[model samples]
Target chain A: MIQVIAFYLFATLTIAAGALTILARNPVHSVLWLIVAFFNAAGLMVLAGAEFIAMLLVIVYVGAVAVLFLFVVMMLDIDFAELRAGFVKNFPLGLLLAIVLVCELVLGIGAERAGGIQLGTPDGTAATAAGASNIEAIGALLYSKYLFLFEAAGIILLVAMIGAIVLTHRQRGGVRGQNISRQVARRPEDATVNMQPEVGKGVQL
Target chain B: MTEFFQTIGMTYEWAWFVATICGILLIALPLMLAVAMIIYVDRKIWAAMALRRGPNVVGPFGLLQSFADGLKVFLQETIIPSAANKGLFLIAPIITFTVALLAWAVIPFNSGAILADINVGLLYVLAISSLGVYGTVIAGWASNSKYPFFSAMRASAQMISYEVSIGFILICVVLWAGSFNMGEIVEAQKSHVWIINGFVANPLLFPMWVMFLISGMAETQRAPFDLTEAESELVAGYQTEYSSMSFALYWLGEYANVLLMCALNATLFFGGYLPPLDIPVLYLVPGWLWLFAKIFFFFFVFSWVKATVPRYRYDQLMRLGWKVFLPVSLGFVVVVSGYLMYTGHFA
Candidate 1:
């Protein structure tokens, strides 16, 4: 009974938050609303007994991705009036896309009703062992059956990260970067030259 | 608990609810008291280190000092900036305070005495700790002030930077332990199945512990990694615009997080509620006392570090988290997992 209540609550909240994410005037509030949607969706996942996925959703999307959104949205000096100016111009195209997407979703649901799709359910061999926890179950499949695919996914992420770093990195001639090794290696004897004739002259530049 | 409640002429669901609320009060009340006492202790130790008297007049050797400070802060009027986002400004500290306490639900206080003995306890801790940054970030942004905004930006970046290294370090420990369950992790330390108990039993894990310690410090935003609240730089960082109980909440939450890190240090590496050695005689003493002793020891170590180390420069801090700790922790994760695989530990 509690589970049913929780499911409905999360489902309602998730939908409401999703609507708010688009309807909110401020981009910052929109991003925050998106985070709320993600959180409620995670709650839904938890209710579905996918604890690992639920935690991952919270950790990855709400924790990291939404924080990035908040960071960017907070820093931006965007004019909301100017943003809304394009709404009517793009409304027809957006409406068409939305209708097509909704049709596809309806078709997908109809197809699913006709012939149910076992989404995210692991294969027989890699199925969760009896009494094993959710994490262990996922790991057993991920590490063994889908190892190569997982590795490929990791490599793709690595390449993307490298690309981002390389694209953002800049080398400026006048910019001074610290050389900690040389800094630590410096001794009073080497950096400070002591001479009796130093009194006659100020110091070496 | 539900059965107990049912036996007592209550409905099962209500019994569960009552049990949960009771459990919360059980942990929270003691935790609040610990915070109070620890604050006094922190002041005393820092004062002694700096050759100062600290607070001696409040109570017997400043026993009531924290309570006095809390009362004083509570009495002060909450000062919200005229231009501030009032709702978010109010919500930020509450978020921080709540998130800090929420992580404690999964922490194994003494054996199976945790509130929620879930499978992915460590993940829950990580998720909740990550949310802690949001409070500071929200507070900073909502203040509608320059220093606070800069503080929030610094805080978010610093937290994310260190979380990477911290994640890798946790992976190393998790790989060694072979489980993410807090109780199981502690049980692994008892040295039952493996050649030795605990990851620290192997010399390779020593460096990982060191890295975990440093990363834990950085993770909690304590000194010298407390760039978020660097008074000399950003003027109390995110809390610059906060006053009264809101500021108090941040203070309490920050300390609670520091204490949680200390507790994690004990639970993950130092055998948690277990005795230092696996001797039979030491089992006579209560486990909670052992846990308490370990927590206090780690807390002292935290205070000691704060007194000794100077705050890191902003660039230097970033360099350490990304260039140094990240690679080192990542390398250790690989090494630990590989070693485990080679030894047929997993198989």
Candidate 2:
């Protein structure tokens, strides 16, 4: 009964917040609503017994991604009218994308309801061993069964990151930056001098 | 606790719900009280370092100073700026205070004494702590002011920079402990090296502990790294435009975060609830006392640093977090994991 209530609560809030993410006037509010949607989606994952995935969802999406979203959105000097001006121009493309997404969702759910397509027969070897926690089970599978695929995914992410950096990074001339190592390595004697001079005599450089 | 509630003739679900509420109260009420007293202690530490008395009039040795200040703030009218995003402005402080308290649920005060003994306890802490940035970010934006906005920008950037290194540092601990469960992490440290009751005793882990301590300080926005509230630069930072109870909540929330960081330091490195030595005779004392002692010790270290160290330049802070701490911690993660694998520790 509690699970039922929790499921409904999370489901409702997820939908509502997701809708608000698009509907909100302020970009900052939109980002915050998106975060709320992410949180509720994490809750749904938890209810599905994917606690590890749920935590990663919260940590990665809500924590890091949404924060960056909010950071960018908050800084934007938004013109609401200008934003709305593009909406009509973009409507056909948006509608096309939404229809495609809805079609994919319907097909996916229909496939699941029609019984999952079997690529291979399930072997007990891949099943989560009894008494193992979700994390352990996932770890076992990830490290043993899907190690190459996992590493490939990591490599893909790394390549994407480097690509982004390369695309955005530029060198500007005449910009003097701090040489922290040089500063640290400098001795007092190297930067200073002690001298005794007679009256009206200046210390030599 | 659920069983205790069940004795009163409630159904299992109701009993569980009531027990959870009771548990929350148990942790939160004392946490509130602790935050208040910690403020006084922080002042005294700062005062002693500066050769002055701190908050001596409100109560004996200024024991009631925080309470008196709380009362004053409570009595003051909440002043909302006409230009501020009013709803968000008010919600910001509550978010700070609540998120500060939320992570405590996963912290094991003693053996089997955790409120939420979830498998991914440490991850839960990470997730909740990450949420803390939103309070400052929202407050800064909602204030609709210059300084606060700058402070908020600094805060968001600073927090994100430090969190990267902090995450890597925590990974080293998690690798060494072989568990993401907070309770298990603490348990794994028992007699970790010979008679030592902490991972800190290990030569490799000691450096990680030091890095964790410093990163923890930065993560909590404690002094030396408190660029968000560097008054000489940004007034009170995100709280510059806040007034009344809202301001007080920031105060309470900041100290609470400090305490939480101190507790994390204790738990992660100093063998939370475990005596420094693993002698059987030492186990006679209650675990919670040992935890409290470790927490107080770490808190003193925090306060001492706050008193003695000067604040960092913003660029320098970023440099340390990224150019220094991040690479070192990431390297340590590899080194620690390799050592664990080589030693067959997981086996």
Best by TM-score: 2
User: Number of clashing pairs, model 1?
Assistant: 1
Per-residue lDDT of model 2, residues B1-347, tens digit only: 99998999999999999999999999999999999999999999999999999899987878999899999999999999999999999999999999999999988999999999999998999999999999999999999999999998998888888888888888888988989999999999999999999999999889888988888888889989999999999988999999999999898899999999989988999899889899999999999999999999999999999999999999999999988999899899899999989999889
Interface RMSD of each: 0.9, 0.7
lDDT of each: 0.87, 0.91
Q: Alpha carbon lDDT of residue B84, candidate 2? A: 98
Give the interface RMSD of candidate 2. Answer: 0.7
What range of 10 consecutive residues in model 1 chain A has the weakest lDDT sum?
A119-128
Clash count list over all predictions: 1, 0
Give a tens-digit lDDT track for model 1, residues A1-205. 6767888999999999999999988787788889889989988877766778888998899889999989999999998687888887899999999999999999998976665765444422323467898898888899999999999999999999999999999889987889988999999988886656555686545
TM-score, first chain, each model = 0.84, 0.89
Candidate topping DockQ = 2
Compose the digit string of candidate 2's lDDT tens values, residues A86-185.
9999999999999999999999889866768642234313234588988998899999999999999999999999999999999999999999999999
- Going through the candidates in order, their DockQ values are 0.71, 0.79
Q: How much lDDT does candidate 2 score?
A: 0.91
